[model samples]
Target: MNEPFVRSGNRHRPLSEARARAARFAGALQDLGIGHGDRYAIVMRNEISYLEANLGAAAIGAVPVPVNWHWTGTDLEHLLTDSGSKVAVVHSDLIPAVEAHMPPGMRIVEAGVPAEIREVYGLGDVPLTGRHPVMDDLIDQTEPAVATDQAPPLAVIYTSGTTGLAKGILRDPVRPEAVPGMMRSLSDLFGLQPGYTTVLPAPLYHSAPNINMISAAALGMNIIIMPRFDAEEFLRLVDRYHVDSVQMVPTMFVRMLRLPKEVRDKYDVSSLKSVVHAAAPCPPDVKRAMIDWFGPIVKEYYGGSEGGAWVQCTTEEWLAHPGTVGKPAGGAAIRILGPDRQELPVGETGVIYGRPADYWPDFTYLNDDAKRREIDGGDGFITVGDVGRVDEDGYLYLSDRLNDMVISGGVNIYPAEIEACLLRLEGVKDAAVFGIPDPEMGESLAAHVELVPGAKVTADDVRGHVQRSLARYKVPKVVVFEERLPREDTGKLFKRRLKEKYRPAEGNA
Candidate 1:
């Protein structure tokens, strides 16, 4: 177990104490009649208890399923239902989300122990306190936390649902043994040392830092947890804590660079060793700026929660290949396959597949076996449905998602959802929305449309229709009138041609 891990905001948790709390929590879970192998959903923002819940669940052999903190009731309700998770350990602030669509028979347990979590589910007379039901006194509280080497389902993270409703990436970790394997490539690439202090600005609810926490803790590194990322405060924390490593979405790096020059130089950043960028694509310009400012310290990783996160491109490597995800990960194999599942020749864009002999945790999609078929090539090879090409040097370059999902301002937006809404408008005939690049926003959505014959419609009308149907981020910024959308020989709209036609933010039309 990890010893010297620190949490963000007010609480500082010592791992040994965290281990004790896990034992108590485990006992409390048993009092609720939760048995080994049962799934417990931990739906709280980043905090000390995330560590506790994970450890406590591990202590008792119960599974811990972390809910994505950003997901609303509409989004979260489906995940909890799909995972079959009852007995939610939730944060007081997020009681509303839990209130909306909690499983009918599921029990609600507050997460943080010292404080009374604020939600009331009306099923309680007196809140259940500590393990052992109603014992005023407790024994074995000081019992050494014993961990088994059993490979059990540790946690389940949903697939973000950028393309559709989220599905589970059910994980089975064997006594933190799988931790080192994932960290090995990253550690070796960045030269991470045991004494290195790492600042985790990303949410721990996600896979990147969830695994990073286990890896850093086992290696005896000081893991600094942030409640959420704030660009200015992140720099301040790094300066104060002598932070050596940081991992974030490429957008975070862009936002940090946006800060005033005076603010950027206010802190001493010499302790920074490497910054890992994930979650979305990094524009070539942004990557180059980071390299120029920090000397090739910005590292880019291209992977997904569905097992293959091996494709990586460092800032310096991008300078050479100019946009290529550096050579395949050691012992990890990638093949770019065409639509027919045939291997594509070099310079041909296709779906990238990977099969790593080890370091791949047993990732299975919960409940829906059909969804599982999409990612797995069977016999260990998996693809996350990303489209990309391979250069002569074995480096990979992602073109887009074959499904035409639009990513705007670093957040993913689905065209099918937007198009479905646009079709509802009275004057609309046909519609398609896609992303185009911008320096500020990594990309922006542009909707191309064909109006019903002689029916007048403006961009604002179409934009208004989309905003009402979906989240504000999904709305298109520009709308273009098209006589007809250009199509390939197969009658499919050629998205590459569409993107090339409608560039970012308009250069004076």
Candidate 2:
């Protein structure tokens, strides 16, 4: 069997070497009394060590909880305690920030920042603090341990926590009988196959990329990992490596489209075969432009971390149906239900629920069973609070999030519709719409926009643009310009934060 080659920036390592390190780390973990069913935390930026830590945990039948390194202070503390992490593997530079927040008796293992990472981020020669046992030293001194034959536990991924505190989604071990089918479905959805060369520009901590890299490694596909995403550099790497496929989000497409024509045309990206995008809705115009640039190879899948991929659409299918997120894949069933738990008529928007017809590994909200029960829509179908409708042919169209809908004078208004219209206007880079309290109407629409570089627009201009396309009631009562909007690395907007900022204070209305 051929070994997979994994590269991040200028650093490269074969899968064999990574496996050796993982085995040694697994030995060290075992020495520390961590094994099957145990949980550990991994807090670091994208690097080869990230994979090593994850694989090492799997070797011992332990679970690795990938924490968003961007979190710090109380947020970081909450995760360590909530997950009951026995140990923490952190990047050297991040140790100081988390040191005071970690739970008592939890061991710490520090990974030195690689030269490639420092050069890319322009952090020159910062020495390791030697505050804890170094990961490399532990790996070098410890003998490799034999891996267990037992099925490894899955990572406990946390939700985005748009409504409140994040909840961990914990899955039971995969049944051996279901492994092959699961792998086949994943391989088809992600376009992973032997000898395929893939690039993962999204953060490894994200659910999609986390699953993507593991699947790619299992399939013996050469993988390129980006420490940070740059519009032009992505195209350059694809051309340089003769990349065959990639996974990206709609924000990436917008950034690539904004690049200068000459700069975009410079790279030879014809080698790409499949480019799958998700994590958020893609505007129709943006999807059309991406198809034009990358051919019909661009595809999309819709699912949450809890449910896995349910529906998928090819560029052709999307062209035919425009905004549909594709019909169900992997024999998954989708249903739109109204407030009374009754099935809504076709084309009538309501809460979207989905589940696989075959085997889907059962999951729970770690330590929060009540939260899991709340999402259950009866008969084993579950929803993540998304509001959407199914077409006559069964393709799904997301109207907006149930939590994000605005009630103005008792009329329902979906922010996604207004945001889509805002995206079409010239000079608009990004837009977010939400509800704010209004004395007369109970609630009113408010828009926050980010403009393209060197572009100028006014609140009236934005209002007029929407007025021309949508109903006057749908137009935002207030429009505010921003230098940039808060978004996750995966292109998901932190709209809850925006909503909080605009939400009326008690007694203000």
Candidate 3:
């Protein structure tokens, strides 16, 4: 029986069909001179073909590089050249944007955008320009690749490049023997098991969601893919399909929580067994509200693409330790280090450095080993530049990104603390806080806020609200209201963009 399937919008394909297409695509890649450990880029929105292309490449031990669709210009060129991708499977509509950036000798395969995505994005149907081979046609013309026992190499996941240029993460291929242990750890981290049904609303380009898709397929779980995240539509899919598990980020939680009570209560979500979240720091209030709404099924994990999930907490554990992301798990080791690289006392905020469970393989930045060495904390631990500390009970609390810390007038400030406070206000919809140049103090705080529609919230109101709970210096000196703050679809705040606005003149700084 074809018990497991992958559904996107109105289209559903049995896993068997998907596997067959993947084998054909793998054969096509090999025919194009792609070899084991070679790379191919996938540049499309969430769709069935994306899955086929990714799986096809991995089937023959080739690495798939999932490029963020939002990327253009140098960011796009850099990733294509950096990954050394021999072929790029791009969406038909997105061809124009990427055509100019294609590196010399790289092949292009166009995949048509599905109706569900076209309707939502209001994208008009564009016939293929025929400048490159089509993915479906290639699959039809090629033969199925031979099966193999060797484990597939992981995708080359690039960092968000918030501080600088994007760097691709290259990991050692998993050994077939280690597959069992790694699968167990993944199942634990995601709270998923085989034969379950799961929904994925997050972008496949992100590391966690990408890994989730691969793992769910491996475990024979039915997968439902959303073209894009819509708070109400998400509920409808879960209720309609009786989805057993789902993964999300903090922003999604905020959007769902903000929905009217009547709209939220319209759909039955009792079928959900596990709801996991990570990728950004979630406010305590937001998390608590989700737990209250979704029952004790809400869970969270803490880690990065570099290490996978090293720490996680359940609903009960989070309730016991408010604001904690949870203690280390999966045989992981963690530390809070000060500027001197000395271990800090309990509850002292500092740079967080750690390694995930041994089941995960070590990785380095592609083409840049020196940068990887920079993050290596002695004794095999790697720091991802996050700032946090552990409590007396060993539960970790995230402060903010280490690069985002503001040193103003000789006092250290963590913007995440203030941003969380801003979100608690009635009218505030979103907020971003960062340091700006101040001639007298070296740096000063600036707060950019997005308010609920029709809500009358002034700059003073924002500062006053923050002052009530935080120190005087923590309050923003400059407050600006924005219709919407710059944020990634994955829910990570793009503070680097905000910082660029206040960047000092090249000669002045």
In candidate 1, stretches whose alpha carbon ends up further than 4 angstroms from where it belongs are 1-3, 112-146, 172-183, 189-192, 405-445, 448-509
Cα-based RMSD of candidate 3: 1.3
Residue 101 of model 2 has an lDDT of 90
Q: State the lDDT of candidate 2 residue by residue for 1-509, as single tens digits.
A: 65678898898899778878988999998887788989999998888988888889777899989998888776788888888889999988889877989989899899999887788778788688977999999999999877888987688888776666778889888888988998998888888899999998988888889989888887889999888888999999999999998999998998899899999999999999999999999988889998999899999999888888889999889989999999998889899999998999999999999986465687999999999999998887899889999999999999999999999999999999999999889999889999998889989999999998898889999999999999999999989899999888787778877888866678974
TM-score-sorted candidate list, best first: 3, 2, 1
The TM-score, computed over Cα atoms with residue i paired to residue i, of candidate 3 is 0.98
Off by over 4 Å in 3: none
Instruction: Kindly report which residue pairs in candidate 1 clash with one another.
Output: none
lDDT of 3: 0.89
Model 3 Cα lDDT, one tens digit per residue, 310-391: 7889999999998988889888888999889898999998999987777788899999999999888888788999999999
What is the alpha-carbon lDDT of model 2 when measured against the actual structure?
0.89
Per-candidate RMSD, Å: 11.5, 1.6, 1.3
* Overall lDDT per candidate, in order of appearance: 0.69, 0.89, 0.89
By lDDT, the candidates rank as 3, 2, 1
Highest-scoring model, TM-score: 3
